[model samples]
Target chain A: MNPNTAWLRKTVALVILIGVWEACADLGYFDPLYMPAPSKVAVALFQLFAQGTIWPHLIATFSAALGGLVVGLVVGTVLGAVAALTPLVGELLAPVMISLNAVPRVVLAPLFVIWFGIGVGSKVALAFILVAVLIFFTVFTGIRDVDRRLVERVITLGGGRGALLREVYGPSVIAWILGNLKVAVGFAFTGAVVGEFVAATKGLGYLLSFAQSSYNAALMLALVVLIMGFVLLLFGLTGLLERRLLRWRG
Target chain B: MLRVDSLALAYGATPVLEGASLEVPSGKFVSLVGPSGSGKSSLLRAVIGLQQPLAGVIETDIGAGDIGMLFQDDALLPWRTAEQNVALGLKLKGVAAGTAIASARQWITRLGLYGLSERFPRELSGGQRKRVALAQVLAREPQLILMDEPFASLDAIVRARVTQDLVRLVELRGISVLLVTHDLEEALALSDVVYLLSHGPRARISGRYEVNLPRPRDVIKARSHPDFAPLLQRLWNDLSREVGERAA
Candidate 1:
């Protein structure tokens, strides 16, 4: 399928969905209090932005998520590389890492809040753990699965250990990480918001809690749409980077 | 230019080749032909220093860095462009970026891949990938080249063309070559000398023949040479017996 046509089809489907949703609300098929029309949600979104009420929460959430993502990506990649290069270390840590990953990250958000307090520190820490485990597995497998023949080719060409890491393993790991960026972004956001839901003074998650207490469905839906917008933006940015970096894949 | 004496190779406790010896004189093409499990790949790995022999001495006048290898699977890095793959050896050697790029581009052009330098290995056809791999090896300017069935997966016409081009390019550079292949015709057509090995569990060089063909030989037409039929027949007779014995 042509890419343009695929995009067009998706846009049409979304438009039709919104049209049906608005029609249902206008025709009183659903109560606006529970299922607000798209236009009402848009108005709520506009009011929040115009009053500048959402900016602080948006910034707080963005900072915690992005900060955690960077920290996790770096730490996980380094640890994974060390594990891959040294088999003994990998063997020792494999089970421990797997067990940690198996634990529900949401359950740990409360512990992080108690430890790091109710600031962005706890949120960032929670997001870090979630993103770290994910990226660690990715980097570890990527490094291990690097083609031995490719490494041999480099070695025979006079490449040493450093060269092998740079030429053979580095690009492979980067490709794997970039391939999973969309998922990583979603996980990072989930970690941040979930941390806020457990305990937080400011964030989109805190606003969600506030909207729930007031029984404001429009505000809740608006915040949800805004969060989705940010996630999509980050996902799109990563996709652009993937295309630029992996142009040779063409 | 290269010599292996009394080489004994094993995979852990299991022996593969024993009492194997061979030589490739300067600027000559030598081939080792054997069945699937006869340890031809193990020998190549040993020579390239990726594997160590149980007991043997491999002597070469050139430095390890001056040897280029073409793997049986092409082994081109899937993430790198053809030009980048070709330029990798030079880059590893600390060549200036401009020099490496220039050299790689020249090889790409020479191998009829002028517009394909930016394409990754996965985007290329089998024949095109082989050509790119060949260009990579040639660009390394190695004094000796070790090829492990570099043309194995290519179609007949492409194989013949690639073989002919490889011979012409290597001969022009006066580079010694040691090729391992299962195809008797490929071995006979391309080499100055061919060694036949018995099948495992203790594969050895069962026979060796010197091809007295002239230089700049066409691999396609070499089969029709006057001496080609008899030489092939004799080697086939020896090889067939080994195959039969292994089957038994």
Candidate 2:
């Protein structure tokens, strides 16, 4: 398929779907209270942005998610390297990391809120746990899965432990971490949003809760669209980063 | 310069190599040829210290850090450029970055891979990648080189060219080599001494031949030497006998 035509087809399909939804709502196919018209959601989205009511919420969520992501990545990489390099540490940390990975870490959001008191700390904590566990596993497996032949080659080339880590394990871990960055970003946002949803002063999730209590379906859908758009934007950025960092793979 | 005395190797209860002994005198090129599963690669791994021997001793005057090894598969790091890959050993040894890269570039050019220093392994063709791997090994200037059929994957023409380059480099540097190969012709053309290993289960040295071929040999043209064909036939018969014994 031609790239331009493929994109045109996607836009046409999305436009048609929205038109159908609008037509159904206008024809009273569903209750307006539960399923608002697309136009109504769009208007709500416009009002929130034009009135600037979402600025504080957007800033709050963005900072919390970004902060958590950076911290989680650093901590996870350090811990993963330590585990992979030292046999005793690897054995000691394996069960703990495995158990943490087994659970849906998002469920801990409410407890984090209770401890950190509905501030950015709670959201950051939730996002940190979510991303750290994921990146930890990625780095750990990445190092372990390196080709044994490559390791032997490096050794026979007079490389020692430090050289092995720098030349072999280090690049392998970077690729794994970047490859998983998309999921980590999603998890970070999920953590921030879910924490706010459970309890928070100002965030997209807090607005969602408010929309829920008032039964404002149009506003709720608007916020959902906003959140999805932002996450998709972040996903695109991470993909570009992955391509740049792993250009050697070509 | 290198000697393996009654080396034994096994995987659990299954013996792969038994009582295998060989020697590579300084500045000599030695080859080990064997049938499939006859522990030729296992012996090379043991010599390089990648695999521990079940029993016996390996003695060498060269230190561990002075050894270089080439594999059948190109083991260049995917993330590093050809030049950087060649410079890795120098960098590890604390050679300054500029000097290391300059030396790497020189070796890369010497291997007929000029102007491809910036290409990654994935971007290079199989033959070019093999050349880069050779440069990576040779740039280190190792005193002892171990090869495990390093040219088996290349086309015949490319293999002959690489063999010529390798012979020139090894001779110019006076490096000792211990090669593992299944090709009797390749062994005859490149090695001063060729050892035939018996079929596995308990593989051991079955025969040894000394080739008094002149130095500065051309790998492809050397096969046309009067003595080459007869030596290859003798090695081939010994190898077939080992295979026949295994089947019987």
Q: Which candidate achieves the best lDDT against the true structure?
A: 2
What lDDT would candidate 2 get against the real structure? 0.91
lDDT (CA) for every model shown? 0.90, 0.91
Candidate 1's displacement at residue A134, Å, is 0.6
Per-candidate chain B TM? 0.97, 0.98
Give me the runs in candidate 2 sitting further than 4 Å from their true place: none
lDDT of 1 by residue, A110-174 (tens): 89988999999999998888888888899999999988888888888889999888888998899
Chain A TM-score by candidate, in order: 0.96, 0.96
By DockQ thresholds, what CAPRI class is model 1?
medium
Best by TM-score: 2
Candidate 2 has a TM-score of: 0.96
The regions of model 1 sitting more than 4 angstroms off are A1-3
Candidate 1 C-alpha lDDT tens digits along B132-169: 88988888888899999888899988888888889999
Which residue pairs clash in candidate 2? none
Model 2: how far is A172 from its true place, Å? 0.2
